[model samples]
Target: MDACSPVLVVGALLLVLLGASAPTVSAARAFFVFGDSLVDNGNNNYLMTTARADAPPYGIDFPTHMPTGRFSNGLNIPDIISTSPACLLSHLGEYLGAEPALPYLSPYMRGENLLVGANFASAGVGILNDTGVQFVNIIRIAQQLQNFQDYQRRLAAYIGEDAARERVSQSLVLITLGGNDFVNNYYLVPFSARSQQFEIHDYVPFIISEYKKVLARLYELGARRVIVTGTGMIGCVPAELALHSLDGSCAPDLTRAADLFNPQLERMLTELNGEVGHDDVFIAANTNRVSFDFMFNPQQYGFATAKIACCGQGPYNGIGLCTPASNVCANRDVYAYWDAFHPTERANRIIVANFMHGTTDHISPMNLSTILAMDNTRN
Candidate 1:
């Protein structure tokens, strides 16, 4: 019964050669990512936006020890979910033979690299086109979808049309949006245009309706299995604490926004699944609840503090951008927040761990490990 014994290996190969499906034998699955800085790897590096993270103290903890435009002290959520060995899901990473999807806009994403899939995420972008207008140049969701289409075309040119379609259909997609719509657009300034147009109660459904369209478009584009994450505890982030909290408490208004939005988001995903006639086409990751575990109880998660960001200045080190002059923590492992807005690599690992094996309360329908197992069996 040795796991890698000759008999098992030969049997697996024979099953594959005979076109017989086996749970243990499956083709390598491609991973496609689309969304904001939370999951952005380095797409912002190629853009001219102020949302860039290509500087010192940013990727000091990354393997290369060089900033890679990830809005974290080290790896971001997508990095851990896809290919990080340091994550608790490293076994799953090995099982999927996961590789970090290159930024779609990167010059290196050509030829055989296209077969590995691409990351279309950009910092500061949101579900709404106007969510991050302050950032001069960034890829909005519309453009990201268009880029995905272009990617598929290029892929078709390389591998034949039918194979390209198959690859995309079997891919795993991750989309993280909505947070910016609140923080950067609606509540960015007093009497902000979005806020002026719609009250908080009205805005949530507006964005959710728009989000459904985006998800539908994704399905139309051949994305069968997508992991859609709700906004994190936005009110508890260091930035909101600095701006709104007077005595080190989560901001009430922004927290209220998250409360209103996340449930609706989950409902929308459920309805979308029903429309697709399957229970597992879209899996909603309850990021707010998972993040609350560490943000409210940093000690339980081996963190010294969650309110104080590892990089930044002013109250909670949550004011201003994480520039070279800003205070930087010597050990990123003990802090929960990286900057005012992003999470440390360690925190990202915890969030992704839930995505892999958490219960329905955290990941609805089924977790990623379950989805992978089912998909592998089906294939």
Candidate 2:
């Protein structure tokens, strides 16, 4: 062939055009969830505990109009993040393939279902083993991690070892912890055991250290992309306000606990990412900042009220758990909270929007959209 043949030039041009026209095909990424009730789908249904939410008014807003062990009146955070077209609404859902990951304990999560990943989150569980001790039979973070390992083994049995490991390494992982550590443990009583063990100053670091270990374990288990959400405005929740607020304001002590916890959580995540030699491995979502937007200014976010629960009784509707006998709101969509501690599905969607496309202030290092774009490029 000639060094500068017209035929060769034409062929090169054609090759470039063909390459430009070909669409990129990225593999469907698996999703893994690990946390507490905020993301729990139906894991608690299989367990015997007071933490269970499989009851009336819990899933009244869900597609089936039936409770599915989710704390919210409708779909929880995880559901909105990974649900199918039927549940799709947020941009994040578009990235997360069809169908939400099934609860690890669900009977249907076997064989081919393993490839879709699983949710290991359990209601009332926290970073520490004793955080939700009162809710006996719940899966603690330690057990959740163990279950993740078991899940990999089960997946390996179906798709061989190396392939399963690769699938996990390329998957997206989300973990929301620490909140229950304070609410259900350190501040459960006037002088709880944890509160007495260490001052708020000291307790924050201890939990952050404990949480570091959990994140490290996830990374070790081949989780390359992980979203670590900080504690939200826990003090602003109806339950806290009812218990500790004197003038219908957020409890100062609990608010201080959250302020102290979230920043430290971000710092720990930053250190973890630096240790891994990658900036995008562990993205920290400032749940407090985004949540405060709707919690403080409900009307701005289209909510009628954030102080009262749609399904509770006492002050702020924050006294007890939402049950069949509670005063249910006429319009669940207008209420920021579904019960004493959980957010309504509408509130959850707003939170997810920030996670998917918020600034560095709301999502440190980079947002979920950036992570998705980068991962897609890599794939």
Candidate 3:
């Protein structure tokens, strides 16, 4: 079943809310991003890591036709979310002004541009410090939080301490992590340290506990509204399908891992919201089930098959990194995946569109569109 019905079920509510007049920004909302490659724009480009995606065929669909270190052929989820009209940033763009958040590592990140926001996401890092140790030089989640602290310090120097704290408090935060913890850590080398230390039953809870610390740190950093994304369809990705499936079926074990993780993530967020004494502060996005719709029923989403990647080689073209030497597909929009593990830009757009408007379990409590609309309406 298509988890995101393009047609809004609550049409009357949408019409009433979306039809409202725009609000003046007392302060422009900043956006901060943290996580793995799914949301990493170009932070990995500055790092000396093989996990980098700055190459041809990786950004063939991008406007520049050159890689910007995004894993997708064009835009990634954060790009879509920031550029969408449903985002508070876009509304603020009208007068208060808006610009794409700068990569935290960029030297160009100084001055007024800091007001927009900053992307601290690294391609290979995860919730655990050791999750993607293979990709040396990438920033871990703990380090990302420290970097956020440093960012606030610099912003305070630019504006003032009080204004900087206020900007961060009103900012929209996006974080995507758990996928790498599973794909790059537990299942990384077979008999990886994490898997050896804890069985699946015990392992997941440990991850959730560690994740709580990360979220708490984010809140402490003055982030008031955060979109905490669950993992994607881990088992259904072309890489996992190629390695585990002889019949092009989603890998059951990994699927079970994701199924185990996502719900726990949702419940944890619910509990965290209660603990914070606010219902909307930590919104959970059920990305795993949402992506499963396109993966399992590719044609319905205009994809020929989710099992084959648009770039790379071997079974399903999913064996290794997508280089210029890889077999590039003619039509990117019809392929669910861009490389072995990452989704195509087209696929990312669809997933983000759902994030903007998807209802019920797809995006718990409320979706991004509703959140932004209501934020504007109340102001």
For model 2, give the 10-residue run with minimal summed lDDT.
17-26
Clashing pairs in 1: none
lDDT of 3 by residue, 138-243 (tens): 9899989999999999999988999898889878999999988889899887798999999998899999999999998899899988999999889888899889
Please provide, for model 2 over 1-379, each residue's C-alpha lDDT reduced to its tens digit, 9 standing for 90 to 100: 7633445434432432233221111246788999999999999999999998999988897766778899998878887777443223242257576456788998877765677788999999998899998998899999999999999999999889999999999898999998999999998888999999999999999999999999999999999989999988999999988888777688888789999999899889889999999988999999999768877788998999988889999899999889999999999889889999999998998888888899998997988888889887878
Tens digit per residue, CA lDDT, model 1, 64-108: 567888998888887667752212233224535555667888886
lDDT (0-100) at residue 167 of candidate 1?
A: 93
Question: How many pairs collide in each candidate, listed in order?
Answer: 0, 0, 0
TM-score (C-alpha) between model 3 and the true structure = 0.89
TM-score of 1: 0.91
By lDDT: ranked, best first: 1, 2, 3
Candidate 3 lDDT (Cα, 0 to 1)? 0.82
Maximum-lDDT candidate: 1
Candidate with more favorable, higher lDDT: 1 or 3: 1
All models, RMSD in angstroms: 7.1, 11.1, 8.3
